[model samples]
Each structure stands twice: as structure tokens, then as C-alpha cells.
Target: MDDTGRTPVVDLRLDRAHSARIYDYLLGGRTHFAADREAAGRILAAFPAAGAAARINRDFMARATRRLAHDGMVQFLDIGTGIPTSPNLHEVAQRIRPGARVVYTDNDPIVLTHAAALLRGRPEGRTAYVEADVTRPESVLGAPRLLATLDLTRPVALSLNALLHFIGDDGADRGHAVVEHLKGALAPGSTLTITHATADFTPAAMAEVGAVYARAGTPFRLRTEAEFRRLFDGWEFIGPGVTLSHRWCPDRPGDALRATSAEAACYAAVARKP
Candidate 1:
């Protein structure tokens, strides 16, 4: 916590809790601190299957990216891009198309610190990082790197995976202001991919779980189908609409259904801009 009142991307607050680090730990990454691991363990003690859930979400990301790159012919704007997890959106997209472009944005300084790995994309393609808040869609859109990645006038896939819940409204519109603003910027054929937490199932455990994050200042916002869908008012949901993370084009059998309660409470969806 220096002049920025925060750790340099890598200056992790091991003593405090953080969603990104907790997510890293759950994903079996070694960049987290002991405290992060402990916090994640406590979360697992409650849900008992958080790690697997996180993996499922990551897998959904891969499936969605593959679908986009194979034919979308657009760049990617991956906001809330977590730490340098393998098979990152860019990696998956670039794999399918040698020169796919990706622009990742996150508020975590740790992400900025470890971004060297995130930046190592195919030479023919482009990869860049922007340290900014997802709520500030303007700054994110204005980043020079993002401008360099692709033509904004063309269709783009905006990956807001596990991001919108963290952004809410006080007395604003039904959907967060930023989301509307973001969607306004996308081209007609662009896509919006999302994975959000829900309390549609497992209310008790999910409530307690939400409390844990709130107390740690890493609060959670569990949305309903209608409320979540409102974020994409003009966009058309792809086949299957909004479902659980595991159900979003899952790769393996027995992995294509979303959990509907605290015993299961994650939602995933991909939609196209009309």
C-alpha cells in the first residue's frame, strides 16, 4: 500500500483477502499467498466444491472463446481478466486463429505484475493488459492497447466473465450503468459472454458465502435470471440462454448443466449483439 494505497500488482495483501488471489488458489495456481489459500479453504469448507466450480467457469471461457475465434473474425475485449491462468482467452483464441487479438483488463495490481506471462501471445497476434476498473467502461475502451488490438467498428467479443456481479447500482438503472454503456459501444454483430454467481439455488449456504466475501471487502452480488438477463437487453442470448457455468457448452459429458442452488449457484451465458 504505497501512494496508490494498494500493492503493486504483485504486492499482494497476504494479510487481507482478495477475490483474484482466492480464485487463483482455487484454480491450482501458485501465485497466491498463504492467507489467500486459507481464505479459499474456508470458502471450500462451506461450498466444498468451489475449486471445481472455478475450473468449470474457466472451461466455459475456453469453449466460448473457441466458438468466437473459429468464425467471429473479431477481436476480444476480456474485462476482469483474472490472473495469468493457462488456456487464457487469448491463448485459446489464438490457437484457433494464428493472429487473434486480445485486450485484457483488470483492477488487480497483481495481474499487472504477473502480466508478462499474459502478454506472451503468438508473434503474429497481439496481447496487451490494461489496469482499470470494469465499471469504467470508457477508460477501458479508450486504452491505446485496446485501440491497437482491433477495429472497434467491427464485431468484437466482450468477455465479462465473472465480472458484472462485482459491479452494482445504488439507485441507478436496473442493469449497472457501465454494462449499458459497454454494450452501446459494441458493434451490431459483437458478442457478450458472461459467467455470474446466483442465489437461485442453495440460498442458505450462498447467503453465508456472500457474507464471507462482504466482510472481507471482496463482496459478491448474486443475481437472478431476469436481473442478469437485463444486462443484455438488446443482445440476443445464444442457444441455451443463461445457464450454470458447467452447462455453458461444457466439453465433457455430465458437465452441461448449471447448479440451481447453494449446493450449486453459478450462471453462464453467451449472447450476440444484434
Candidate 2:
């Protein structure tokens, strides 16, 4: 609506703190406003390692994408695709397979506003964005742009990194149900990659962090390692099964041991649909 030629379907809401923008602020990006920076300051006071956690989580996404592309998977569907950070999922995959196709879906209007950055993929490859929420898996999978960009009949690498924590369990297993629905829709041999925040490693710090997000009107639920593993039920885990974010198929020597479990505060894994 503000000159992008496409009317904004939702409000930008710069007055409120958004998880995506808070993350951008924590990562030292200039895309955040004062509200986001204020919330980020509270989060850092509660969990000083937040910036490191964000970086390591992003690094995991890159490693997982490269591995999947190297394994010959040519399509990627990244739900909760956040603000388009450099070396995005498509950038990583297309680096390995120039013709790789990627569909990035997110509920954030800011992400939708800057989607052009995400769309800039290699000429041989394709990238598309869907302004949809992850809770509504049908809308994401059935989106016209998503369908046109990637062939669902083929193996696709699906990533839900650092996203599930925002979806409260609500005592009905809603989070797990959402994942199962998405998993069922994918073809056999497709891979599911996830990096989720957990309280298992540092319960007190994570609890404080959760309180901060809650006060900001965002639901935050840090899961246990068992709960995280259950999200991948019925799938075959790849090598180095279910480790800290920095430990999952680390790309460098000593990388796995670099961050303490409490500092990482997140669990990550890659599994095959088989």
C-alpha cells in the first residue's frame, strides 16, 4: 500500500514488538524499530546468549540446506521464513544446485514487504513467497505461488527452524498436530528439518525469556528434548541425530563443542520422510 504497488493485506504494526524484528535487532540488522529494540533489550537481559543462539540457529539452516541439496533434493519449502537474512535457504541450496526451487512462507507483513530480497535467486533457480501462517498448513501448501514454484510430487526439503516455540501446545498437542499435517502432505523421501528452542538445557533462563515474550503478547513455549523429538515421529533421522543447533553436522572443527547446551538453548535435527 505504501508504494510497493501491492496493497498490504495486514497492518505493519511498527508500534508493537514483533518476534522477527526483535530477532533482526538482536542480530544487529537495521530493519527493526524502537519497539523491537526495547523488547530485544529485555530478552538479552534475560538470556544474554540470545544473539549467539540466533546466529547458530541460522548457521544450522545453512548447513542443513547445503546437505539436502548435496543429497540431490532440488526443492525447499521453508515455513516461518523470517526476515530475508543474507545467504537465505534458497541461496544456500541454489549454491549447490543452481536450479533448485524454494518456496518461503511467513506470516509477517515485514517479511512480505521485503520479500523481494528473498526472491533474488540464481537465474536457473526460482524463489517465491507466501504471506501465510504456519498454523494453517493447508493455506501454505495449497498457495498458488508455492504450487507453481515447486513440484510437490518430488522430494522437498521442508524446514521449520526456530518457529515451533512460538506455537503454544495449549494442552491439546496443537503444535504436533500442525507438524503431522504438513508431514503427511509431503512425498516420501522428502526431508524435514527443524531447529526449535528448548528449556531442557537451561530451564530458569528460558523461563525468564518466555516471560519476556509473553509480556510482549507473543506466546512462547520452550519444549523439552522429548517433545522436540516427537515432532519428528515416524521419520528416519539423519546422522548425528538430535543434537544442539551448532552440533548438527557441524561444518567446522570444534564447532559442535563451541557452544554450551545452555547457551545454544535449542535442539535441531534432519529427518527423512521414508
Candidate 3:
């Protein structure tokens, strides 16, 4: 254990080829194995901009959280919460709204292993970490431990960031099902913040990236803009709906349109409950 009452979280046998660790490597994180690094390197070699795309996705998370905290009073439910990246959802939200409450969920055992970092929150705010799968929403919301920290009576901002690709697009593995369930459970004024990788901009690179994930046991599936918009069917999308991650309400004007091709591969939008 590394003083967090949890194990050091380095497992090689089960699967050194996990999406979380691969992403960790891409983002210059130190929690990846040689195999994961190799995969990430191959992807980066294919698209030299993959690292920048990862950074843009990370920026999207921060930007979306800023929107939630300043413009809305809703709590947050962040699923597919990856490794403990700095300025995480809770950190961003709580910084803006000191009383903001956040609940994080991730099925990855590695994420669970490092969850201790997620529990840290502003003294005035609330944060809780739950080890659960997005494919099973009931198990998450119904978990007594998490429900205690988050109040379901009001709105909650549900974030699905760079995670949908991991969910198979078939009948049972469909990620839309997970979104439907969570959106169904939220109250009015709630918001859904989603950012997904797409092949609309870079077909060849996207194909190769998908293949890399496939070989690593985490095949990526790109969703079209229309299919992604369906995720917010009932919600009232804020201005600039279903736009590129770099286009979604940047800190200032004129930034979105000039976004690079790599960053544009990811579609990001935030919609509020009507």
C-alpha cells in the first residue's frame, strides 16, 4: 500500500492493455506498463496529434465542469472516471461552487485502486468515489454509500467523457442504454455532458486508433454526430449543441473555430433537463 490504505495498483497479468492505462500513457501519466506505452506510442506515431487530442479532451472536462458550476447548481455524477488526473471533475466544480457535490464512478480496477485521491475535496464541498460499471446504472445510484453523499431530489450533471468508445455499440453493450437510464433518473434542470471520439474528421487515423484499441482489448467505436446527439434527445442543449470539443464554449471567443483537426475528432456538448 502507498499510504492510501489501498494497494500500489500495478497489475500485469489480467490485462496490461487496459484503456485507462493506455490513456494514462497518452496523457504522459506514469501508471502504465510497457505494453500500454507501446500501444500508445504506436497510436501517437500514426497520428502525431493524438497527444494533443488527449489534452483537448482533458480540457473539455475542465470547461464543461466550469459551465456546470457557474451556470447551474446541479450536483455531478461522473462515470468512467479515469485515473486520478489533476484538477479532476470534483476539483473544477468545487473550485467554482464551493458547495458543489460530486460522485465519481469507474469500473476499472486500476481506477478503484487509486480512488483514494478522488475522495479529497474542498472542505465546503462533497465528493465520493464508487467502483461501479456504467453498463449497470442501478447498482451505482442505488449504492447506499454513494447515495448518502449525493441528493437525488434535484439536478445532477452526468458526465460521459471519452468513455463511450469503450462501450460496445451492440444491443447489450450499447452505451446509449446507460445514458438513457441515468437521464431517466435525473430531475428537471439536470445536465448531461458528453464528449466522444469520432471518425468524421480523420477516417484513416480513426481506423488505425480503433485497431490499436482492439488489439489492446479495448476496441474503440466512433459515434457519428447525429447518433451522439440522440443521447440528449429530451434535454435542452445549451447553445452550440453537438459541436467539437474545442468549439464548446471556450474560455473566450474565436478559439473554437480555429481548433486543430486532431482536437476536432472529438464531439462535445452539454444539455440541461427541461
Candidate 4:
């Protein structure tokens, strides 16, 4: 609560590597520490294109946010929001619709420490942060801050970019179930956007990368295209359907062509609740 008037729960946990920090490191963010860099190095050894995958996934988030905002969606609920990356979901959405409302939730305390950056949105819009885990969707959806910033009755654009893969199947298809529960809660006409890691293109390399995250005490489950598609079950796809992260509504001429499927290693899509 230093100067931002927000008290951050400071459990730094610099001793072990965190998936969020590793992703921040890969995305060339400075919020990571030494342990994060070491784990990122091991992941890079297994999958050299990890950095590219991270960037491509982030670009997909930006594109999805812009599309949703441009299409007249005003409320955004971004669960598993990572470290404050520039042009964040709120920034992208607010830029398109200044009155857009965004609520970001993440489990990491570091992200809470930097949550101030996420809250800095257009004056016409509203932004809020909730330090909560995605596994417990109830906690996130019922958070006071989230409720205050977003109207549950409105069509909210829910973004789960590069997040679901961390939730292992656990023999019950828990990840998909959680997503379904969340989707059920949103209003009709709401949108669900996701970008998840997949081993379809480079199984061997991705397996090694999964092993690294496993060793780091993180559950890394790379799903297939069919499994990825199931997450959006009962919803209608926006356009182009499910595709590689880089190929999902590319904004620039060479954006989609810049990364191969193996290099991107993630599947992305946007769908409406209808």
C-alpha cells in the first residue's frame, strides 16, 4: 500500500520459479527475478521458440480485445491476467472504447504489486483488480472489486489467454468444466476468448517443455485441437475459427506469416455465447 493506496499481499516467493514469472521473462518483462530467468532458460533449451509463442499469444489477446471492443462489447473480464504487460487487455479495449469496463484477476502477488498499471485506464472507462485463482471461478466472479467495476448483466468479453493449459486435467476434465461454469455465468451475447498451448505441432519439444514446468512444480497440460475446441462448446466462433495464435485475426500484413505453427505452439479462438 505504499503510494498507490492498494495493499499488495507480499509473498514474493523468489526461491522458486512461477509460471507467470517465467512467462513475464519470456515476454521480455522486468517483473521477473533470477529464479524465473533460470527456469525460462531451461524452457528455452527445450523449446527455443517459447519467446515467440509468448509474444504471439499476447498479440492474439490484443487482437481479440480490439475486435470485441470494436464490435461494441464494453465489459471485459480477464482471468489469469499475468504481469502488467504494455498494451494490456484493458488498454487495448479502452483504446477502442473509452467507456469500456475491465476487471483483471490473477493469483500472483507480484501481479497485485503491479496491479496499479492495470488500473490506469481511460477516465471514461473503469478498471479493477482481484487477486484470485482461476480454479476457483466463484471467488473471481464474486470478488467485490470485480462486481463493482463490471455489470454481470452486460455482455462481457472474457479473455483467458495462455492460461487454461496450466490447469491439468486431473482425470475429471476439470479445466474444461471450470471454463463451462464461467461461460454459463456470463450473459447472452458475451464473448469468450482463449489461447492455450498445444503439442499438436511439436509434441516432442513441447513434452520436454512440459517436463520443465512440471519440475518447477507447475502443471503444464498441452491440449489437442479437439480438446481446445471443446472449451468453446455451445458457443459460435467469431471468424476464421480456431487457428494458431499468430494466425488469429492478424492485424498486420506479415503478422500471421511471421510464425509457424510449431513456433507458435498455441491454439486461439474467439466465440460468442449467443
Task: For model 4, give the RMSD to the true fold.
Answer: 2.0
Clashing pairs in 1: 9-109, 9-110, 201-260, 201-261, 201-262, 202-261, 202-262, 244-258, 247-256
Please give, for residues 1-274, the per-residue lDDT of candidate 4 as tens digits.
Answer: 4223566569989988998899999999998888889989998998999998899888889888888899999999999999999989888998889999999988878888888899899999999988888898998898887888888998989999888999977798878988998999999999999999999999999888888888778899889999999999999999788999889878886888998999999999999998
- Point out the higher-scoring one by TM-score: 1 or 2: 2
For model 2, residues 1-274, the per-residue Cα lDDT tens digits are 3222467777878888989999888777878998888889988998999999999999999999988999999999999988989989999999999999999988889988888999999999999988888888998898888888988998889999999889876788777889999999999999999999998877888888888788778889778889899999999998688989999989887998888999999999999999
For candidate 2, the C-alpha RMSD (Å) to the true structure equals 2.0
Candidate 2 global lDDT: 0.89
Off by over 4 Å in 4: 1-8
* Residues 1-274 of candidate 1: C-alpha lDDT, one tens digit per residue: 2123455536566687778888998899988887777778788877877878788788889998998887655488899998989988888999988788888889888888887888899999998888888777788898766787768998889888877766655566523578788889988899988888777776666777677687677757778878887777878887688777777666676665444334336787888998
Q: Give the per-residue lDDT digits (tens) of candidate 3, residues 180-263.
A: 898999888888999999888788888998888888777587888898999889888886898888878887777666667564
* Candidate-wise lDDT, in order: 0.79, 0.89, 0.83, 0.90
**All candidates: CA RMSD (Å):** 3.3, 2.0, 2.9, 2.0
Please state the error at residue 94 of candidate 1 in Å.
Answer: 0.7
**Model 2: per-residue Cα lDDT at residue 81:** 88
- lDDT of prediction 3: 0.83
The residue-level lDDT of candidate 3 at 60 comes to: 85
